[model samples]
Target: MTPYAIATQYAVTLLPETDINSHFYEITVDYRGHGLWAITRHRECMNHDGDWDWEPIPSERTDEWIAAHRFDLDTALRLAKEAAPHVTVNGITAVEALARSARREAQS
Candidate 1:
């Protein structure tokens, strides 16, 4: 499996104004049917006075959002590395190990 990541930008809207802050991103790679999924959702602390408190954004519509943003897996991984390189890692080894184990099981 290829490396994957998710990035999010926060836009705060007051009753009469708007503010944008640092973009938050995360990367995760699948391995042996398990992997780490780290997210830094809404890391911006630029909440202005009288602005609504930060609220969790729904990800159920992520497919639509990804389409709207015109982001592909490569772009996503690149963005993730840019935002947080330490979070991304290789998973090919784990996948290979899993596959070998599966093949052995099948033969058994």
Candidate 2:
């Protein structure tokens, strides 16, 4: 499926150190089939040792992550459409791809 991208305002740090740390991050919640979603948070931000500190964390279709992060199917679709409604593949938007994937799982 075409992964939907969500750009969060900015990373919240306890210390609020530098301007670079305040930059926005494009967090992608990828649908890994079987009603599973994994969130890829802060891909650009690296640790002092040069490792991806924020990796893709797994979540269920009906998890609290969906509520807190507002990543449910409908919400994701709305956000994606608002961001780039014109982007399509075979006339299907990112959210439509996600919906199709969900429907496929349900029908099976």
Candidate 3:
């Protein structure tokens, strides 16, 4: 399988005014064709506080948004890594695990 097949795809959405502060921005990650693997929402902030404070958004909402919106995978990944450095490590680990799993499945 191509690397992209197992790699996580992410997208961000900025909401308009009137919503809860915690749900100002939506972030999503998709794994293969298994639909959304993760989703989170962040409060709008001008600067990073260096704290893990994102709230987990519902999977149904994430799936609906992802289906409706289109995202540039490269840019999204870059931005995600920039916004949360820890995501880089998570992304790499996820990719490696997926690749290994695929290889094992193929061997079987």
1-108: candidate 2 lDDT, tens digit per residue: 799986433222221233232123133444544443333344422222322333334443244433333344444444433443223455655456555556766798
Q: What C-alpha lDDT do the candidate models reach, one value each? A: 0.30, 0.38, 0.38
How far off is model 1, as Cα RMSD? 19.3
Using TM-score, give the best candidate's number.
3
- lDDT, model 3: 0.38
Model 1 alpha-carbon miss at residue 46, Å: 18
Name the runs in model 3 displaced over 4 angstroms: 1-52, 56-77, 81-92
Better of 1 and 2 by lDDT: 2
Q: List candidate 2 stretches off by more than 4 Å.
A: 1-29, 32-56, 59-66, 85-108
Q: Ten consecutive residues with minimal summed lDDT in candidate 3? A: 41-50
Write down the TM-score of every candidate.
0.23, 0.23, 0.25
Residue-pair clashes per candidate, as listed? 0, 0, 0
Q: State candidate 2's TM-score.
A: 0.23
